[model samples]
Target: MATRRYLQLDVFAARAGTGNPLGVVLDADGMDTASMQALAAWLNLSETVFFVPMQDPAADYRIRIFTPGSELPFAGHPSVGAAWAALDAGLVDADARALVQECGAGLLPVRVEKTADGKRTIELCTPRRQALSTPPVAIPASLQALAAADAAPVLWSNGPAWWLLRANSAGAVRAFAPDFAAIAAFTNATDATGLVIFAPEAGAGHDVVVRAFCPGDAVNVPEDPVTGSANALVAAWLAAHAALPHADGRYVASQGRELGRDGRVQLRVDADGDVWLGGEVQPVIRGSLDW
Candidate 1:
């Protein structure tokens, strides 16, 4: 009924149109929750972000994240995409070198690092880690059949709930064809977003290669080109259990090769054990929405 401005963003992309796509609906104030959910379902992307004036007094702006199926308390790519969209709309300034984001998870601090070319890298502080129960036998067996890693599947949450499985090599992660039926059953039983399979070292410019798979009954996203929250969980777990060999407390991770998209996520663990997940965003389409 009215015109609104929005941005289509590519998160964690090394190039345009190669990263995960996000729709940031700005000027979305007064839009009812049902309308927002309907629009998100219509958009049919992994997730859509809606921005409005701050509800929390401490936050500069408040954002709501919705997938086609349901709403999420927090999401990585949407947070990054929202940050870029907010910056573009003058909702935030970099004077303090940080941005605070308020969502279902609470207030999160985001670091703003600007490059020489005026491109900015935004690193959002992930919520404290929440380690959940282990995966069922079938889940581990499913991954074992494809790869030779014995590492058990771990379910954890930084924002949205997740399950992580470790493979022996990055090649193993790349070559496997997922059994979505079995995986969906596992997800149903465990209430996790999906499975994230990763290896210690791989890729040309990254320390680790991660592949995320989300299988569902009807509307399913077989693979996520880039996932911020999953990698954040990985960083927290590894920092606590097994430290990386060359870790200067920060490293770059690669993902999305299965989808032919070169996506990179920069994860850092500060001396205080805080995990920061970040990436560069590229605006693919800048326009106004009328609907």
Candidate 2:
């Protein structure tokens, strides 16, 4: 057993507690996978990340992400939170504007920048997207009411897989009550991580609203407060279908309201059609882990 630096962070938070929480363990170089998984299960957050020394020359650091039940190739909130933790722990140069993260999905680029109000923000460039022609499993009848009239459900993969659907309105997204057992069964059968539904908002401060329901076979996270990767895939779907509500291919996503958290995710699709996810991260706890 050894002591390791640990941080609890709120990613994509509009404030201190209104975002998804992530547990991060630093200097996790020698910890075996079983040990790491045990620590993650004990933490019981939606996801926990272990920061290890860089395994690839191109990366500033490497991270292993785990849920209470299993590990993931990549996850959005964990990636964003891990980047902030790396900077806060002095593992990366304070002045560095960018970083490369090595994870099971491979090397992903991260950008550090200051918001117009001068608050620091972190953004991750998602991997190339893979869209499935049809959902691996049929959409459950229970969720059919939430579907938008004009859009058909699509499945997208960027390390983790999610079935993307358009909702009729932001209110619908917020008001949705999911059937955890059915959703879990669908995800497990489809080999997917979760399902995401999004809708464009008109007068709200944010451009869209999104909700993710991920009930894995091993763990049951009924709804994610905020999800970066799902939102990225939504952006890709919108851009590819010429359905971008915003002319600039940039929009803010509102999430977490149903769970009593307020999360805002910034999404931008560049001219080359690459999607980037950005948001503010807040440190909630700093301590050490003994494992």
TM-score of each predicted structure versus truth: 0.94, 0.95
Clash number for each model: 1, 0
Candidate 1 lDDT by residue in tens digits, 82-186: 877788778777444677888878888878878898888888988888988764546646676655445666789886778877777778887878887777777
Cα lDDT tens digits, model 2, 1-291, are 688888999999968999999999988999989998998888889899998777799999999999888898888899999988888889999768899999999999999997788667999988878986564567888678889888888778998888898988888887888888899998888878889999887646688889999986644588988998899999998898897878898888888888999899999999998898989999899899799
- Candidate lDDT (C-alpha), each: 0.81, 0.87
Candidate 2's clash total is 0
Residue 29's lDDT within candidate 2 is 90
Candidate 2 off by > 4 Å:
115-118, 133-136
